[model samples]
Target: MLNNIGLPGLLLIAVIVLVLFGKGKVSSLMGEVGKGITAFKKGVKDSAEELEKSSADAARDVTPPPSDKDKV
Candidate 1:
């Protein structure tokens, strides 16, 4: 889809956006979007770590008991 937007088309769209929203609103919106993306990434990383920790704990709790076949 984006490949269809050549340089001239992209420039025209950018000019329209600038005229409609101005620089300040666009920059502020971009900043908020970046922050949201960063926060979502952090949340995913934290959840993955927590899942690893819980799986490790569960594995430790499932050890086999010692057999008495050779208690000499």
Candidate 2:
């Protein structure tokens, strides 16, 4: 369905949006959307880092150091 919407269709949609919500409103809305996207990306990055750190920690805890008795 969306594949049929070419440049003209996008222009029409933009005009309609501008008319319904004035220039300032649309601009602010777009700014908020941008901020939301940035926040989402940051959250994803932090979560991935936390996961990696936890996995590394768990790996260290799972393996014990060799004892002196084993050297015999």
Candidate 3:
């Protein structure tokens, strides 16, 4: 059913929304939506970076084991 809503349907919906909300209200709403999307992307990037940092931190040390002579 939704697939049938092609460009014409979308345009009609947009027209109705614009008429109901007014141009300025719709513009501000779209701006807020854009900001939300940007914030969400940044959050995802930050989360990925944090996970990478944590995994790098958890890596095993490359130094050789201590010799038996070094034992007490």
Candidate 4:
């Protein structure tokens, strides 16, 4: 069903949305949407970085201490 909405359908939808909500409202809404997307991406990146740091720390902790026989 969605695949059937080609360029004309998209244009029509845009026109209807513009008619319902004026240009300024739409523009501001788009700006807010862009900001939201940027924030979401940043959050995801931070989370990934934190996860990597935690994994590295865990790996370091898992290392065994030097044995007495190796203390020659």
Name the candidate that leads on TM-score. 3
lDDT per residue (tens digit) for residues 14-66 in model 1: 99998999999999999999999999999999999999999999988896777
> Which stretches in model 4 have alpha-carbon errors above 4 Å?
64-72
Per-residue lDDT of model 4, residues 19-60, tens digit only: 999999999999999999999999999999999999999988
lDDT of 4: 0.97
Q: Which stretches of candidate 2 lie over 4 Å from their true place?
A: 64-72
Better of 2 and 3 by TM-score: 3
- lDDT order, best first, reads 2, 4, 3, 1
Q: After superposition, how far is residue 35 of candidate 1 from its true place, in Å?
A: 0.6
Consecutive 10-residue window with the lowest summed lDDT within model 3: 56-65
Off by over 4 Å in 1: 1-3, 64-72
After TM-score superposition, the amount by which residue 31's alpha carbon in candidate 1 deviates from its true location, in angstroms, is 0.5
**lDDT tens readout by residue for model 2, 48-68:** 999999999988897678999
In order, what lDDT does every prediction score?
Answer: 0.94, 0.98, 0.95, 0.97
lDDT of predicted model 1: 0.94
Per-model TM values vs. the true structure: 0.75, 0.82, 0.84, 0.83
lDDT of 4 at 12: 100
**Among all windows of ten consecutive residues in candidate 1, which has the lowest summed lDDT?**
63-72
Quote model 2's TM-score.
0.82
